[model samples]
Target: MPRRWLMAALLALVPAGAGATPVNAYPDIARAYWVEIDGRPAWAGNADQAMPVASLAKLMAALVLDEEADLAGTVTVSRAASAATGTRLGVRAGETYLASDLFSAMLVRSANDVCRALADWHGGGDDDTFVARMNARAAELGMVSTRFANACGHDAPGQGSSARDLALLARAVMARPRIMEDARRESFAFASLDGRRFSVRSTNALLGQFPGAIGLKTGFTPGAGRCLVALAERDGHEVLAILLHAPDRWWDTVGLLELAFDQARRNAPPE
Candidate 1:
């Protein structure tokens, strides 16, 4: 069966009104949002509306790289990668680093430079090929509302994703232990083959402040505003929240996570 049809069929199995919340439950929190508790939908608003997601697109890039590239391999920074805009590790063209280090930098720091280098390496010096792979992977993972225009999550025409689609993508990312390990990191440090060192801290503010927060990813752009995919586990219950174009993502995410956990507890079967 075609991937889209399979995805549609799977989505049909979710019960209507399963923990549905009013679209305006949290007014002005974000342009689009979705929350899930223990793998079931909990609340949503404009969840299917596609919008620019900025660095959150890195999650999908990480996924595609993990599936196809060898982390242990080395990648030399290309001129295009070294010239990438946005958050970067300042790697110079021709510098070589382990693919794993680049992967960590991409997730932990949202470093566009390393992300581009990884993509370029995976595409045999052509990041566009890697982006095509990313789009294909998005389709295979049932991210029907998601598309990749670049490996580093730059804002571009036709590059967008919905909160619902991001939730699906996040689930796929969480299933990969290596990727999650990187996501959970608060900071990463590494050196290139030339012995030039670099360090980067995670952009996810909730990592140290929010109890039980295990990361997911964060994003921002002039066009996308602020975006986040937050995952937290407490008392054997897990809550996953996605926010797109949020003005106050940190505060909004914390409230949503707490609400989801509370609902899970209230709905839990008695001991």
Candidate 2:
């Protein structure tokens, strides 16, 4: 009798065999995925289908700059680069910066102007050439679901990427030793071409809010509401989380991360 009751209680705790949380429970998100450091797919829903990434696309822009430009090289900011819309680094025409500085700005601050400047300064020869190279790099990286029409991740009607493609790209960026360091920075400063100092703060609200929340990026537009690709580290394990088309991106992202960490802990071997 006691043994039968124990079995029932244990079964009750099993939670229907660990399926994903209900969609209505998280109504704001269109799709998401949480990936372990070992490249294991832990949780996913609507991960393979392509969707608007908004400013999260800037992650690719930063990676492309990291690969193609010498971080120490100087770039003279063009009028076109400085005049870009949305969030900016407040750079002016004729301003110049070390390529790495712009890369930092692009990743840490999601600076639209810095992205354009970096693309123009080192993307083959011109803006068009640089955008082409970005797309080519995406293909080479097996981001078949991704298409880059601009360096700053502007709201182009057709430009988008799947959660799988983003996972691949995030893996590629995280693989580089320097990128982790760059993304983890909370703030950065640099001098423009005119020698004026510029300092930028990160847009990822969870950086210091949640435990082990590293840096990624945050984005939105009317067409794409509240997007994020965030990384967190706990107990020597790293997990990447991506959320798209979310309305309450801040709390939703935090909730997903907490759930992922909880799941990881439950699955971990006893210490």
Candidate 3:
């Protein structure tokens, strides 16, 4: 049988309506996928394919910030940062914001300006250096299929990563206390050096909508389509779902999490 038909057959086992979780019903539109259950690989489909990941790459920026940069200091926004497009924070050149605040903007709001601002600050006013650090860190983490060309995850020709590599990065991000806390919150608030107040809300919609949903990140571009790295914890079991170009990410993630936990439960020895 064809793959789509097989998937459909598998999904037919799920009951409709109340308490039904569609297992193996991932959308055909998804380009690459990976899921980890309790820190172990549970599913994979073309998870090593290098493709544009859009704002998901900003997770690396957050990782880099946590490892190398001074997160508590103040960073001045440069023209390069102020000029960032595709998700703006309305920051202007010559403005100064807390490095911690900018980091919050990058994760919570997916603000490209903060990505650039933080990178520039870390690189001593040079983004290239920061990108080099990102690549190096990815390599150190065994992300062989990943590369970063820019601080913000813009669609550049050479900028691409695989789902598996991103999963590894996500594990590292979750290990850090600050990064995990930032991901869990819906919004981060702070005042600028100029004393203007600003609040940035996270782009991850699953927080309030889905039970046990914590965070990760979301990415999209004309080329990347809808991408998401979702983390959900229930009954002390954690599941991480990574989907690239998935048109129905929120639903798929929920289903995938349900299936993972169910499978794990079935495999457990009787007490």
Candidate RMSDs in Å, in order, are 7.7, 6.0, 5.3
Please give the CA lDDT of all the candidate structures: 0.87, 0.73, 0.82
Q: Who wins the TM-score comparison? A: 1
TM-score of every prediction relative to native: 0.91, 0.86, 0.89
Return whichever of 1 and 3 wins on TM-score. Answer: 1
Winner by lDDT between candidate 3 and candidate 2: 3
What's model 3's lDDT at 262?
66
Q: Which ten residues in a row have the lowest lDDT in candidate 2?
A: 8-17
Q: Global CA lDDT of candidate 3, please?
A: 0.82
Q: Could you tell me how far off, in angstroms, the CA of residue 197 lies in candidate 1 after the best superposition?
A: 0.9
Taking the tens digit of each residue's C-alpha lDDT, what string does model 2 give over 1-271? 3453334334323221234332222323455543443245555557666777878888787777777668888888888988999888788888767887788878888888888888888865488788788788889999988887777778886688877788888888887766777788888888876679988888888887889987677887666667888899988766687777776777766666665566566666798
Give the per-residue lDDT digits (tens) of candidate 3, residues 98-136. Answer: 898888878888988878988999999999999999999
Better of 1 and 2 by lDDT: 1
Question: Which candidate has the top score in lDDT?
Answer: 1
Candidate 1: regions farther than 4 A off: 1-24
- Which lDDT tens digits does candidate 1 get at residues 54-115? 99999999999898889999999999999999998899999999999999999999999999
